[model samples]
Target: MKFKIRKSKILRNLFIAIGLLSLGNLISVYLIFNTAGVEAKVTRLLVKLLNVNLEANLPTYFSSLVLLADAILLALIAYGNRAIGGRFWHWIGLSLIFVFISLDEMIQIHEQLRAPMEALFNTSGLLYFAWFIPYMAIVVILGIAYFKFMMSLPKKILKLFILAGVVFVSGAVGMEMLGGLHAEVHGEDTLTYALMYSFEEFMEMSGGAIFFYALIVYIEMNFEKLRLRFKPKKKKKKIKKIKKNLIEA
Candidate 1:
């Protein structure tokens, strides 16, 4: 039997996962606010799992997984670009960026830089996190460089890709700014901080889900069919005596 998966089917499953994860993050935030006696431990665990509370936890792991998936899909698309006599290196560069992001997510590399950034900037406003400076610059550069390529994409995919970038950056950068300001003023232990983090994580995951869907659709549209099949079971047969007798006859 063959296993057939349409692009829309894959996208639906990704969207469902994104929705569930978003709900989980929201619940985690609620628990943080309602932490009572016995519920305090549960709340702590949920916070650790759902936000940037700690390293090597659920949210970080899930983010890494999504980024890694994005990197793989981008790499595959790069190969497709090569096959079609397009700018394969450009796609490869984007894929490498995603890979770096995946690694950063798993290792919490950016979090480590926060202290040095704070010291260097000598400010606690938007630039408290110095990484955003370079990050935003890179984003702008990539946007300008790929503007035409993005325009060349099919309208549906182009729209989805742009939407995904906007959502992801809004969370990664926009919410980050808000959280940093709050933490600078009220410390990082407030309900507001937690809520902001929850929204940031949700947006990141949702953006990844959208990007994954777009990439799947792109591959399905451009490449040959994708399917899976299991090998049929073989049956043992008796000796071929009947066949030999018929030949002799």
Candidate 2:
């Protein structure tokens, strides 16, 4: 049976998936703070990694910047690929899984912090975590779907995910390069310094995760298609050759 995907449905699904994933992430955070707790060493490391000075609103500003960039990225992606909008639901579902996994990672990495450890979120943090829900959710569901159904999808779409990963990596490098220039001239605490730049780091991690696994998903989804189109055709041709030889003999 041919699978038909509606564009409107795609948009709706994307929104929903994003919502679910975001919810899961927040829930994880809530649970970690409430139950798991973080390590003291990890807490120090996060503060240092985040580079939050007492004077500057760096954490808040940095978070805002990261999320803003992420949102812009999602918009750009949705614009370029209609599938992002149509398969929006799948993406959203995947996002929930993604967030939970990442959240779990965070919890695992920091099991010694105070219950209300300073997460240091801002407007951008909200945005980053918010849209992040869908990205993570879609990936999670697809991962399971591969093992469960394993329907072969198209190569073009698969390539798109790889391309998307490459593009995102490129953007991260660009951000780092740009930030580096400013840091060298401005100083360590300057906005250009990598330590003070959550925007670039967040993109590197979040975008990287999406595209890296996206490539995996794309390949798994299209594995059957590639086999059918290439391998199956060769099998048919060999059968035809054998039949002709038998007839001639």
Q: For each candidate, what is the lDDT?
A: 0.77, 0.41
Residue-wise C-alpha lDDT for candidate 2, range 34-140, written one tens digit per residue: 44445566544444343322212333233233334334433333332343234333444444443443443333222232122323332122232232333346546
TM-score per candidate, chains pooled: 0.80, 0.30
What digit string (tens of lDDT, one per residue) describes model 1 on residues 1-249?
Answer: 122467677767767776776677777766766657525676777767765555787777887898899999898888776766777887798899999988987887787777776678776776656667667888999999998889988998899998999999999999999888888888887988887887887788778878988887777776664332233333212336666778899
Residue 88 error for model 2, in Å? 30
Q: Considering every candidate listed, which one attains the maximal lDDT?
A: 1
